[model samples]
Target: MATFWIVIIAIVALLLGTVLGFFLARKYMLTYLKKNPPINEQMLRTMMMQMGQKPSQKKINQMMRSMNNQFDKK
Candidate 1:
C-alpha cells in the first residue's frame, strides 16, 4: 500500500514538471523571436517582384485601411 502511494505521487510530480517545462520553453521561444527583428517590407516586396508577382497598390491601400481600423478600435 505504501509503495502504491509512492508510485502515484511520483507520476503526478512527473506530469506537473513536464507541463511546467513545456510552458516555460514556449515563453522563452516567443520572447527570443520578438527580440529578433524579422524581414522588412521592402525586402519582401523586392523578393516578390523578383518572382514576377506584382502586388497592387489598391490592395495595399485597402489592407492599410483595415489595419488602421483595427488599431482605431483600441
Candidate 2:
C-alpha cells in the first residue's frame, strides 16, 4: 500500500512538472521572439528588391508598421 501511494505521488508530480515546464517554455519563446523578431527592415527590403519592387523608406516603414500591428493583434 505504501509503494502504491508513492507511485501515485510520483506520477502526479511528474505531470505537474511537465505542465509547468510547457507553459514556462512557451512564455519564454514568446517574449524572446517579440524582442528579436525574425524579420527586420533590411530583410524586408531585400525581399522586395528581389521581387522587382524598389523599396522606398516610406514603403518599408509602412510595411513594418503593418507587420507589427498584425503581430500585436495576435
The candidate scoring highest on lDDT is 2
Instruction: Identify the leading candidate in terms of TM-score.
Output: 2
- Candidate 1 — which residues are off by over 4 angstroms? 38-46, 53-74
Model 2, 1-74: lDDT tens per residue? 99999999999999999999999998899899899999999999999999999999999999999999998887
Q: What lDDT score goes with residue 60 in model 2?
A: 99
Query: lDDT tens string, model 1, 1-74?
Result: 99999999999999999999999998887676556524445655676688788967665556556755664464
Candidate 1: the clashing residue pairs are none
Q: What is the Å distance of residue 11 in model 2 from its true position?
A: 1.2
lDDT score, candidate 1, position 22: 100
**lDDT for predicted candidate 1 compared with the true structure:** 0.70
